[model samples]
Structure formats: C-alpha cells, structure tokens
Target: MARNPARRAALVDAAIEVLAHEGARGLTFRAVDAQAAVPAGTASNYFADRDDLLNQAGRHIHVRLAPEESALAELMDAPRSRELVYRLMRDLVARMLGDRAGYLALLELRLEATRRPALRAALTRTLRENLKRNVDFHREAGLPDDGDTVLRLYFSITGLLVEYLTAPGVLDEHELDDLVGILVDSALGIGPHHR
Candidate 1:
C-alpha cells in the first residue's frame, strides 16, 4: 500500500480532511495535494475535478461504513437487538464528531451531490442499499414485517443525523440520544405503559 494504490488511497483519505477543514469552497487540486502530501498534478491525475474527488470520497466513506453497519448487524445475534441499536447510535455520534473535518465534509458532499444527477443517483443507490441492510439487520433479529416501518426507521434516523450535523451545537450528545430514543421509541411503539 505504498505506491500507486497507496498514493491513491492517501489522496482519497485526505478528501474529507481537506473538505472539512477548508469547507465546501476549499475543495481544489492544491488542497487535496497538500493534504495527501502528493504533487499537485498527481491528485489531478487520479481525480480530474472536484466532483471526481467528492465521488471518490463518497465511495470511500461507503466502504468504511460497511464494517460498522455489519458489526451492528452481528450484535443482533446477542439477543439484545434494541440495546445494540442504541449503542450503535451512540457510537456513531461519537465517531461522527470525533473528526469534525471528516464528518462535516461528508455533509457538504452529500449536499452538493444532490445537485449532480450522477452523484445524486449514486447517493440514492447507496442510501437505499444501506437502508435495506439496516432494515434487514432488524428483520434478522425478529423484527416484524411492519410494511413501511423499516423505511420510516431509516429516514427518521437520517433526519436526526442531518439535524445533528447541521446543528452540532444545538444538541449535545445526551440531547441527541434523548431525541433518538424518542424517535426509536415511537417507531417501535415503546411506551411507559409497555416498557
């Protein structure tokens, strides 16, 4: 991982760092090159433009996301699916904020990708697939066939995540957890009278 593949990986990895630290306007050849410690022309060689780089970042983020999603899915086998989801949510929040630059860049890319048809299509596919995976995670653990319930769960969480990213200062971690708990509880129909 120290040559072409390595350099490619480095620049790709640096994308979030560059975007987050530099904001949406900071995505450029020089920024990625500097962040990746590569020659200016090299990044351009791999990624011809900002859209190309952001597209790569989207793919990279998707790949990295699989493990965490799978881990959450696997933990469902432990007989504590709901608890696992809660923990996963908490961990996700921590991880998202752990590297403000990376997470912020993700948000920015997601926003801009919405304006690019190709990127938007890629995003739609990625989101749909991931949402299916998550819903399956629940189904595998005995969640009932609740029709649109899974879709609601996914988009609901997505909403929460977007709000958190856009207004990180608005809700502290505990508040976020509380908000998610409310949403999850409502989705699962958990109530004081029940549990």
Candidate 2:
C-alpha cells in the first residue's frame, strides 16, 4: 500500500528472488526484505499480504522475462513459417532456462494458486491475458491465429519448457526442434512437408 515506486519495485523484485530460491513456503515479507537488503517490514509496508506480494512477483517476472522488443520486431519482419515458430520456441526455452529460478517461482505460484480460489482466479485471468497477447502477436506476425491451434501450441510449449527447465538433459536442441517443428507444422500447416 506504499506509494514509493522505486522501493516497491525493489521489494517486488526481491519477492521474485525469494520465491525463486525459497519456493512459496519460504516466501515471506521478511525474506523479501532480506533479499532486497532493506530494513525489516519493508515488503509488508508495500504489500497488503502474501498474496499481494505473490501477484506482484508474477507481474514482475513476466515483465522481466518477456521477449525483447527488437527480437519481436525481427520476428514480425521475417516470413512466417514453421521455421519461425521453431525459432520462437527455441528463444522462449532459452529464456526460461536462463531464468530457471524465476520460472520455478512461477511454477510455484501456479501450484499455490490451485489451493486458493482467489489466487486461482487471479492467475487464470493473468494467464488468459497473456494468452490473448500471444495470439495477437501471432496474428500481427502473420503466424497462425486460430484459437484451437494457438491454445494447443501454448500448452505444448509450456509443457516442453517445464520439462527442459526441470531436467536439462531430457531433450537436446535437435530433439526439441523436431518436436516444436511438428507442433508448428501441425498448428499452421507450414514447413516443407506440409507444403
């Protein structure tokens, strides 16, 4: 409930770090304050409750991890194809892997949501908004925009990302590409074989 933007942002970022390293059970206002190297009660000052901090962490994580504008513009400028989809997936996976702790915290948030109706509803809304944004981006990039296709692609990529992030050797790039290529080809009906 504090109005200090810089301090609030730092607390939220620290919440992400605490969530990432400590999981939901370990996430606390005190932990966040400690992570941010601020005085005790700093997070409590800014957040209404644990749920508020968790929600803010989710938003911060998404912002921090979202694709760069330049990369997206490059994709938008390129020809849309299974190859492009594959590349996009690869980049997504790479980013997830690069921020393993953050993604893990997100996964924890998801699990925690399942046990709390309010959190579940909030997470669902946030996820749906993100999905809509992805679909819109796909449309703008001249990629597949069909709802079913986009939905399936979204889940598939998320699952694959989870697997890759949790267990590194589960699939090599060649294998991941092959899987993504199949999904992309199936979704958009693009690629050499589809042609």
Candidate 3:
C-alpha cells in the first residue's frame, strides 16, 4: 500500500530528531514511532526496514545542501560572493564544532553509507550533482570554472573544518578567511601580472 506522504514526512522528521538526539546507535523503529506519536506498525507501514528509514533520513539531510534555481539565484545576487561563501562555510564549521558529538554521529552515518554499495552509489550521485551546482555557483560568482580546481578548494575547506573541529583550538575563522581570500583573489583575476 502506498503510504501517506504527510505522515511519512512526519516520521522522517521524527527520525532526524532521533538521529540528531540519540545517534545512529540509538535509532529504532519504536523510538521513531514514539517520537512521531504513531504506532510502531505505522512506521513499518511507511518504512519497511531500518536501512529504508535511514536512507530516507540521509536523503532528507542531504537535500538541504542542494543548489538549484532560486537557490542559485540567491547565490548570484549576494553581495561579495567570496565573503558570503566564506561566512557560510565558517558558520557550518562553527556548528559542526559546537555540537561535535552529535554532528559526528551524522558524519558516521555518511561514512557508514560509504561501505554500502547501493547507498554509496546514491550518495556519490547526489554529491556529484551538488558539486556541479557548487562549481556553477563559483563560475557565476566570477571564480574559476574548472571543476577540479573548485573541488580541490572545496575539499581543502572541508578538511580544515574537520581538522579544527577535531583538534580544538587548532583552526580559526581568520585562517579560514585568509585561505578563502587567496582563492578568491586568484579566481577574480587579482594577482601580480594580471592580464
């Protein structure tokens, strides 16, 4: 039977809450059902198994990063795309560090999905789409359009975030901005011997 989307959404929401609050180790259908104020069987009706529930939750969180249409428009019109980009990434790093334990749980889910063939493929596809969107945003912001270049910068930033978050007091916003500023300068045709 086709499930009720509204109710399913509610369950997914509850699942995210549970995943955030309890970690993947604590997530269970009964807890989700209880969180959603539904019968255990009700959750089963929507998600037949644990992996199904997790995949849905992962997709829900993953979509939050999508850049498309109006999302791209917002990026295009922002004042000082470089600053805006740096701020956004900085804020995410701050949050990731702030709730290191909980966010680490979510990160574990992503890592676990890496070893699961089907989920890994799906994750790779989603990440590729997002990477393309991010590269396009960089081009629109007058940055270099080379995918490999943009991806390298992206990984560098993410790596810095992870390093700082894990090591504590090892990374700061000033350093992050400095690095991004260098990239922006290169991308914006501001360099010695500019043509």
Candidate 4:
C-alpha cells in the first residue's frame, strides 16, 4: 500500500462520499478514484482490498463527525442542568446536519456490516466505545441524567437522525427543535409537572 498520508486521507474521504451515495455494493476502487478525482488505481494503492477500504471509511466517518474540542470544553464549563442536556443534544443534531453525508455514510456502514463479519466486529467495537465515551462524558460533567439516560438519548437521537435523513418529509423540519427537546425531557424524566 502507498504511504502518502495526504492522498490516503483524501481517498478515504472520497470513499465515504461514495458509500453514502452508492451504498456498499457500489463502493469500488475505480469508483473511489473517480470520486476522489484521482487517477485510476489510486485507491487500490492505499487500500489492500474492498474490506480495507470499507473499514477505513467507517473509521474516517467517526473522525469527521466527532465533536470539536472547543465545543466539548464549552459544554464542560457550562452548568450541568436539564437545559444543558437539551443544548448538548441540539448541538449533536446540528453537527450531524452539517455533515449529512458523513452520517449517511455511517448508516451505510451499519447496513454493510450485516453481511461482512470483519466489518460487523469492527463497527460493533467502535460504536460501543463511542457510546461508552458519551456515557463517561455525561457522568464526568456531572450531568443530571444517569448513564442509562445517556444511552436512551443516544438511541432516540439515532432514530431521529435516521428518519430525518432517510425520509425527510416524514419529520417536519420546523418541529426538529421541539422533537429534540421532547427526547431530552423524556430521557431525563422531565415531565409536564416537573417543568
């Protein structure tokens, strides 16, 4: 495989885009090269095979969607309240919205994992680690909710994202903030009487 970091990164990114648009079956070295606007066989030089490319693309999407340090710092500095939880969830939605293709690529990876054992294992590990990190961050921040609450929030947000991305009209865009607020409140047990 080639050792050009810049070119390799570019190819991985392009592979993400291709995966998002074309699904796992459509992902190919030639397609990746075309997506990257690089010469044919460029992706092959960097990736050992289709599985390697898919795995790399899965990792790259997470990196692309990760929260910014500044944002994390800001969240940590804020008071740990229900309101803060709402803001955090809102920020997550915004980040995913901003990188629609990255989130879409991740969804594709999840689908592809069902057929590929190696990918299934890799994705399962990565996703479990990510969930643990979020739970840890919530606890460390002294957030109002427990780790289970965080898990619930994660599932709820993922469902919202899937619906929002895959079936746009199914979810009213104007009600997104309201929907997120409801999810947070539900996860935190903030009912009408509590609020």
The C-alpha TM-scores of every prediction are: 0.80, 0.86, 0.67, 0.96
> Which tens-of-lDDT digit does each residue in 78-144 have in candidate 4?
7889988888999999999999989999999999999999999999999999999999988978898
Question: What's the best-to-worst order under TM-score?
Answer: 4, 2, 1, 3
Tens digits of per-residue lDDT for model 1 on 64-171? Answer: 544465665565555545555565556666666665566677777777776788878777787778778867766766664366656666667767777777776766
CA shift of 128, model 4, Å? 0.5
Q: Pick the candidate with the highest lDDT.
A: 4
The weakest ten consecutive residues by lDDT in model 1 span 75-84
Instruction: After superposing candidate 4 on the true structure, give the runs of residues whose Cα lies further than 4 Å from its correct spot.
Output: 193-195
How far residue 23's Cα lies from its native spot in candidate 3, in Å, is 3.3
Report lDDT per candidate.
0.70, 0.80, 0.65, 0.91
Clashes of each: 0, 0, 0, 0
* Decoy 4 TM-score against native: 0.96
| Per-residue error (Å), model 4, residue 172 | 2.2
- For model 2, how does the per-residue alpha-carbon lDDT over 1-195 read when each residue is reduced to its tens digit? 679999999888888888778888999988999999999988888999998888888777788778899987786576786567778877887777778777888898898898877778887888889999988877767765565767778888888777877786867655776776776666665665664
Which candidate, 2 or 3, would have the higher lDDT against the true structure? Answer: 2
- Which numbered prediction scores highest in TM-score against the true structure? 4
lDDT of 3 by residue, 74-141 (tens): 64566755456555455545555555544444565677676676666666776677678778766767
Give the per-residue Cα lDDT of candidate 2 at 145.
54
Whole-model lDDT, model 1 = 0.70
